[model samples]
Target: MSTPVVLIHGMWCTGGDWKRVRDLLEPRGYRCHAPTLPAHEPTADQPLRVGDRSLREYRDFLEQYIREQDFRTPPILVGHSMGALLAQQLAARIPVFAAVLLTPAAPWGINAAGLANLAPFARVLGRWGFWNRPYKFSREAAAAYVYNGLSPERQKACYERMVHESGRVAYEIGLWWADWGKTTSVDADAVRCPVYVVSCGADRLTPAFAVRRVAGLYPQATHRHYPDRGHWVIDDEETEEMIHGICGWLRPLEQRAARGQQAPR
Candidate 1:
């Protein structure tokens, strides 16, 4: 049996977004849980802000959840976008078996890649309909971004069901990544667990180059570049193929544990 797997979502999204992925993984004997962040829920009384919470707070939440739940083992932490960066930070502090980062954003520590800092501009542009204009979640933008890797019919169907996100949170992510090391970024060298990062080739939000940088940071990291996929790789038509790739990578580690061999580092 595979170990438990925890799913963490990116900014503005709730744990509910991972339902499809969870369903796909659970039938394979791998238990899956997608924990909701403290303040990201639409039903929350008060929303969280950029400085309102830090990366450490998020890591601490997962750590507590693990301990309280009594999982079979220190499970794999699978995260997307900002959640991916947080997963690495959590692994560094906790005894996780492994981590999988999907199109991880660059950690805040490095100042060279400053593009993330520009995300806040979306808010101002949003007011001017700049972001909502040329690239609004219109059918064309949806086809290009949200549904790039899926079939045309699936793209149209899924895009119809998509909802608008929090502009405040989007701007906050900008500030969070801009002030990463001082606040949100993790120390890559501190992470000792095995790490796997899947880079989305057509991701408009986070490019493959950013994921490669994360791979370069970890001592036991493997990077796979998906040439035709977008950021929401799970929704793509080839998602099952990607899931198989993930299970294939994890199976050997599971077999090693059965043989009393130390889990791969």
Candidate 2:
């Protein structure tokens, strides 16, 4: 059996958002699992309560799924934005082979990327009850922030796939300082696995500077900063290079594990 790869997506998107990455991984001796957040599905089967979920709850969902699968080896955890934070938490708690965090949302040390910072650019996301109601940033807001680099047509298309995110989860991320739950704090010391982090210079939602701090937290992390790219790293174009990079990084590790009879899949 090949190593499993869990593809975790950011806010306002479902597992389908990882399509570009998944398509590339499956053909390369890897099995991909992309689980949609609760009530964040394109066509949600359950009642919509996304706004009611906390950061811990989101991480728990990913953890539960992993435990149920009971993979032969610790799966590679790949995540973006909010999903990135979840991946970090999972690695801290479980036995993960590796993690690829793409513009991961801030946990504790970084406050610049919080939802509070988006208040001026996107008021709705930071409005009252943001931590207690379902919310999805408007396309206008996206154009001003996360979706800035894309053309108008492309931006529109990406916006269409957007969905409501958990307000409580937002609270845990942005207002983590006030949270007694300690939801967004990642135990860096507990993450005993290889870590790869990406930060886009053009990204405003998760500032590259703060993301750099994320890489620094790890003992020796692999981080690539793309000055030209925006938060949408897996855009329809100019993505093959990064994807190839990720593939190349994992190949040697997988080969070594296989050679040692560890399988790593």
Model 2 lDDT tens row, 37-100: 7788776632266778777777888999999999999899999988898999999999998999
Which window of ten consecutive residues has the lowest lDDT sum in model 2?
113-122
lDDT of 1 by residue, 1-265 (tens): 5578999887545688787788789988888889976555554332323224545566688789877878767888899887887788788777788899987766764332335334434444456422222122557665664556777888777665544444433433444544434555677777887788899777766777767877888868888898878878755666778778888898898888789887777
Structure candidate 1, residue pairs in collision: none
Candidate 1 total steric clashes? 0
- Compare the candidates by TM-score and give the number of the best one: 2
C-alpha lDDT of all candidate models, in order: 0.69, 0.81
lDDT top scorer: 2
Quote each prediction's TM-score. 0.79, 0.91
